[model samples]
Target chain A: MEVKLASSYGFCFGVKRAIDIAQKYENSATMGPLIHNKNEIDRLQNDYKVGLYRDLNEVKPNDTVIIRTHGIPKQDLKDLRAKDAKVINATCPFVTTPQQIVKKMSQEGYSILIFGDSEHPEVKGVKSYGEDLEDVHVILEKSELDNLNFKHDKIATVAQTTRKKEIYLDIVNSLILKNKEVRVFNTICDATFENQDAARDLSKEVDVMIIIGGKNSSNTKQLHTISLENCSDSYLIENETELDSSWFDNKKLCGITAGASTPDWIIQQVVDKIKKY
Target chain B: MEVKLASSYGFCFGVKRAIDIAQKYENSATMGPLIHNKNEIDRLQNDYKVGLYRDLNEVKPNDTVIIRTHGIPKQDLKDLRAKDAKVINATCPFVTTPQQIVKKMSQEGYSILIFGDSEHPEVKGVKSYGEDLEDVHVILEKSELDNLNFKHDKIATVAQTTRKKEIYLDIVNSLILKNKEVRVFNTICDATFENQDAARDLSKEVDVMIIIGGKNSSNTKQLHTISLENCSDSYLIENETELDSSWFDNKKLCGITAGASTPDWIIQQVVDKIKKY
Candidate 1:
């Protein structure tokens, strides 16, 4: 029996930087939970005195306000600057790149099409940049493409930074067939692709795979999906306590991976517990 | 043995109209071989003294010049109108619809993408309408779609009226994947689809299929291709004399279909020859 960890797992550069910034400003109130991992957020609150506030109005004068790694809407930045709160911009640079692209292309008269979950914060942030344009649309799935009836022929597209590369390319391929002109900007970050590929590679050789991350985290959910496709015994857990010994009853090999938002301490706990099984 | 004709086959409305207009003006010279059928052109030339002239320079002053069924370029129309020749416009309305759509869309600043053979007269005619515009492209196959790189996002597309509906739709399906915004105008005439569908239906129940049309006819070639896909024993013939009795040996059921330009007499002769076999 053997247990292995993915080559690329745990907190990415952006998430690491965000956590370091939040820890640097101890007792600070983040605009939202600093990251999707509830265990990490509780640790920050109890150990470092960091607090989570869902709304901008919760931050008082002179109180430090840290932005989440997913980034905020452009107007929110302006409104924050107008206040007396100490602002910490923790938006992932990879996510920022798409926001700027949407703003620039929409200004050039190209209609904007975003390939991602419309309800996701990262997608919502990107969509806000193009919301001022007359022909902005968010396509959550390929089936939604059939409902697109646009007067403007010019079109520019961007994907959520955490989206799968193949799904984005598949949508772009379909768009080219229906339109004479198309401009595509690959905005998905390297971290997301690396983590997904590593998890997929590990799952193929393992009998049972454990994915550790917040249930609400988009990238974590994506890793679980990829792992499950390659290995049906894949399970998503936020912590070691959720692990069941029955899952490893006859499993000779086991694989483990964590989402970008997951902390090193939590991953080590999950790995240590899985080894005991 | 059973011999059957497609429920909807023979000269289409556009071809019939062109023939009627050409026959009305005796001793007239057509701009090109008015239609694709060589036998029909020869019959008109010998029986009615109508001549086929490749160049506009061949028509004498005061001589009648009939436009071909596939239509001509916009510049050719201007050059024809500049002379003192009696002009009889015989451009097929179905083909003309795509030409006008291209001209209108291109004039409105939309880049035009045409799906058809670049060298075909109908495509050439449609391409000419948008040649004055900055961006106009002709894609004959789905493979050529990769070469399409455009700065302008607005895209409008039209297909040659005689093109197979499935081929055009397949290209459109592929284009939709690539472009953010697409405007599709299904320019394929009903006659082409009806004929192709009828031929395909007959081919399924028949042991052998005979496709009658000019060797150079686009729609006829499409029908032959469709028939061959369903029945490998399908054969394309220009006239009754080309039919071989050896092909009929062991073939219990035979289906017949003709191109839009093939005259009724040619189809009748081919049917009689096939019956005698």
Candidate 2:
């Protein structure tokens, strides 16, 4: 059996930068899980003493606090600064761009539409930036647009950095059809595109596909969904222990891809474990 | 045969306003044909002494010039004013909105993409408003997007008032897929939507469809195109004289629609002639 890796996968620029920033400040605490990967966060804690605080209330006045890659809401950041905690922002630039666009467009009197999961922290943070929160809408499906009644004829939309581009386009097309003025900002990161495209291309050539990343990672789930379209025997796992030996018994070629939050060390361990099959 | 008319058709607000403005100033000349219909222009000339000029050079000092519904270029308007001609701007507010957006977005360093015919006067005028004319592009088809290399990643797109909404959405979707930031202004008029939607609904119910307006009218052509999709026996004609009696020979019901440039008198003549069949 032969194993192939996707041409582009794992640890995107923002995640890598966030990890580096955390490692530099030993004994510091992150406002949230710095990245989605639990194993990486555990590693940072054990090796560098970088701890994760699930809530802002956990941070002490003198503690060093690192913002997660998904970013915290505007009020949360202001509160953290007001508490006198030393802060290091690790929010991805791609994520920040949409935040700025939402704030600017909202202030300019355009209603904001965010195409992402409403409950996701990234979307919540982005939604908070809108000048008029009442006019801000976060929707995961195009069908949800029907329920929205905007105060303004002008609409500005931004997508989560890790969302599927096809779904974003569908939402945008729907907005254009119904609205008078639509301002669409394609904020999905380049890394997401490259990784997903590579996974799709590799999955078609293999009998089975293995997607590795945090179970909660959006991009990882997106990769798994795309891979399943081309290869039915696709599985998403966080690490080597989740891989089933029987699944690869009849497969001649196996394709592997990892989400942006996945670390290279974890990918190496998965690859090494799969070799024994 | 029973004759039916689309609920919404003919003489949109802009065209009605232009005709009213043209009628107010007798012995005046329009920089271009006031509306697309030749018959309407001829009527204006004979009744109101409103003549037409093919070029700005034809305008004499002190000549009262009425701008067409589809605006002339910014420079042309300036030249007309500089030539001491009293210009009555009858440009549709819908069309003017896109021109203003393009000018503002371009001046703010965004590239302009006009999803319309390059030869269309409205598209040409909109393109001319871009601060850097070199960064403005006019395209009719989605495939044409492949050849365009925008000078700026920030793109502002606007459609011609009469363009099909589906085609404009296609162009916008393609642009969003390839670009980073896209600002889309749905400059398509409500009248176009109403007329097209009515034509589509009527065509589906009738055995034969008749679309009336100037042959060169974009909205008329769009209605004809849409009608042909639902009813194979769709015919486009400028007036009653062009209607074929044979089209009604076997048809139990005929649906009629007219473009924005079409006047009520022409629609009545067509309806009267169709009843004779």
Candidate 3:
């Protein structure tokens, strides 16, 4: 089978920046997983001696702490500063923009609505910026809006950087239809759009699709989901080892795509393995 | 034929407030038509002896000028103040919100996208607030967006208060899909939503639909357009005098609705005349 790569795929500006920062600050510990990709984190840990602190309590005084791309909660950042840890913020600018917008708008008495997974680190961090926690709602579906009781008529909404634009638009349209004064901030990363668009285009022409990215990575999952819509024989794998030769038995062409958090090296391995199959 | 009125219709809060202000300030001249309804303007002119000034040049120094509900351009307001005219600002708060948002966002270096008719007074007023006029674009259709050359990546969009929510959503979705940092202000008025929803509901249940308001009124034209979507025999009339007996022929159930600027008295006349037919 012939292996083809998507026109736009793999490490986005934010993920690339975070990786660079992680590499530059060797021996420094990140507040959370620097990026969603476990393989990339492992590489950073082995090569640069970068350590991961899943909990804030793990960090010691005088330690250099690098903030992850998804960012930490406001209170956590304050606590880290109070602990006297030398902080190196590597939070994505796209993620930071929504945080600022939520802080400013919520402070000005506008109810905040975040269109993203509530359990996500990016969403949790953005939600913390709202002045009134009760007024800040994180919802994944448009139907969830019916359960929300907004304290203020004015609402400001922002989407997670790695989310699908169509889903974000659905939530925004629902908010606009119900609320009189809604402010929607489009915070979905540009790389996410390009990657998803490229995957969707390539998946249609190929007999089988292989999406390479961390299983937990939101943007990668989005790309896999989009590829599944076009090609039924689509598979999501972290590396070449996870690839099944049986899936590509009758496949004349194999299209490859990776999430924003995925590294080029991993994609190259996946492409090489598919060519061997 | 049975004449059934829509659940929500007639003069909205803005129009009612404008009318009340016009009545209170007798002998004053409105900078433009106070509302879109010609019959109501005639009532204000005849009953309160209020004058209408089509042009700013018609106003003499010290003339009391009541700003229209749609609002005049920023420069026009300044000129009126410079002429020492006593201006009783009657611009709707809903309309003012978009004007302020456009002025603030545009001044902060964001490109402005106005989803409305370029010739509309409300759009004209809101467009004037943009600090950089070159970056402000007034587009009626999503296709028009392709022709626009934006200097800034950050864009702020606002809809005309009287516009269709669905069309506005289409424009917003299109903007969000293309731009990374789009700020959407849902300036579509609450009354507009209620009126359109009510008209749509009532039109679906009736054999014929009659929309009452000024022919030139944006909201009134929108009501007629929506009514036509569900009811093929939809008719738009200014008052009972415009109604024809032929329209009621074989029509068993007639639905009635009026635009935001339409008066209840005119709606009552249309219903009473429809019953007679």
Candidate 4:
């Protein structure tokens, strides 16, 4: 048996930068959680005085604030600033690309369609930027296509960063067949796409698979969904204790994968447990 | 704005099935076209009829016969009688799953590790049988643990139905700390993982992202990966004339993404067209 490594494993540039920044602003009264990863978030909670105010409503004058990697709603920032709070923007550059699209589409007065979960922080922030325009719709399925009358009027669309890469095209192809004048923006961050690709490539070589990340995190879930379709033996484990003996019984090959939010140390733990097996 | 389509997209289970069996039988002959992506690899080039040859020397009765999803791998009643023919079994279980792992792994005395490329068909195929393994390794970063040099161990590892997912793990924690018996397996199919996730997500929601495919084929570069990702603005056009100018203007939002193996489509078409702005 030959042990091999797929080449696409590492902390994405955005996540790495966010962590470094969070370390610098650890105790800022206005600092939000470091990132979406539970482990990282927990570390920030323990080491830093990150005030989880939820939204701008929770803060007061002179309160120092740290933003998460996802951008905040533009109005919220305005409101916070009016209250004289200090703000540290840690939104990723890849995420900023979508903001440009949202703002441009809104300015053009094209009806907006965002291809992401309505609840996603990135989507919420992008949507906030487009208040100058009247309508913005969040879509998840082909049925959502019916909402458009194919009026041949300009419409602009984009996506959440962590969404699956393939489904995006299926929906777009169908849209073009029905109407012209529909505009689109490929807003998915490059880092997210690379992570998805890397996970797909890595999952193909091992027997029992472990996808390490925060369980509630969307990118991690995306990795889990992609990994499971290819390897049933692949398990998404947020903690090392989740490593079960049954997954390792009498098997020679094993592989591990992680999402964008996954930390290196957690991946290290998964490696040690498999070595013991 | 300029649009770019990703280079990988849209692989079916049937096609991946064919590819997996083809890889294992690469040393010999394939039972049929390894996959359905005609634009990708020509079927005529990769496969041969199972019973056509007998042996490598005389090309007669005992030559190796490979298995394909459309046909049988183990059921060689006609060719088994041939004096010069041997059999190599490979089948994709989206069409079939083998129940033989219990007998095979137990007989071989190998610990099992199964890796699945997140979105490939071959990864799905291998994990179906890896349930009995003690610790399944389905990630790439942790593959170093798979290479334990235990003296008294027999292990068999298997791969997913697709390739490009074999990620080898790094043993940073030092497996020497754990005293455990081990066996390892390497099973990754082919370019399936590389193709599916890389291109599909970005194609949707962009203006005039071109998908290139053979007009006569299905699931080629133009079909699933291309047309599926971006719903509103994706174009599955084989060439440039199909692009509409109205997709862009002096001031507009635009994005581009692509499917896999669409080398026929020119990226300059997008860059030049968007530059009109």
Best model number under TM-score: 2
- Chain B TM-score for each model? 0.79, 0.80, 0.80, 0.38
Model 2 lDDT, full chain set: 0.89
What TM-score would candidate 2 get against the native? 0.81
lDDT of 2 by residue, B56-86 (tens): 9999999999999989899999999999999
DockQ of 4: 0.01
Over 4 Å off, model 1: A1-218, A221-277, B1-4, B20-29, B42-51, B58-64, B84-88, B108-111, B131-134, B141-155, B161-184, B188-194, B203-211, B214-255, B268-277
Candidate 2 local Cα displacement, residue A42, angstroms: 3.3
- The C-alpha stretches of model 4 lying farther than 4 A from their native spots are A1-6, A9-12, A29-34, A148-152, A161-167, A170-180, A190-197, A214-236, A244-253, A272-277, B1-277
lDDT of 2 at B264: 88
A59-93, model 3: which lDDT tens digit per residue?
89999999999898999999999999999999999
Question: Model 4, range A124-230, lDDT digits (tens) per residue?
Answer: 88888774534777777767877655322555667774556456655654543343234555556567667677768767766766778777877778887887777
lDDT per residue, candidate 3, B1-277, as tens digits? Answer: 7989999998888889988899999899898899877888999999999999989999998889999998989999999999999999999887798899999999888999988899988889989999999999998787888899998888888887455678888988887767756777777777878888999999999999999888888878999999999999999998889989999898899999998877877888888889998
DockQ for all candidate structures vs. native: 0.05, 0.68, 0.43, 0.01
Q: Alpha-carbon interface RMSD of model 3? A: 2.3
- lDDT (Cα, tens digit) per residue for candidate 1, span B156-192: 7887745555666666656554554456665656777
1 against 2, candidate with superior lDDT: 2
DockQ comparison, 3 vs 4, better candidate: 3
Q: Is candidate 1 or candidate 4 better by lDDT?
A: 1
| Candidate 4: tens digits of C-alpha lDDT, residues B1-277 | 5544455443445555455555555445544434434433443343522222333334346456665443332324244536455655545443343224523664455444444443444443344344443433343345545564533233333434332331321221122113222222222333554554454555444444445445544445434454455554545554455666665544244444333333322445645656665
| Recovered native contacts, candidate 1 | 0.00
| Model 3, residue pairs in steric clash | none
Which candidate's DockQ is highest?
A: 2
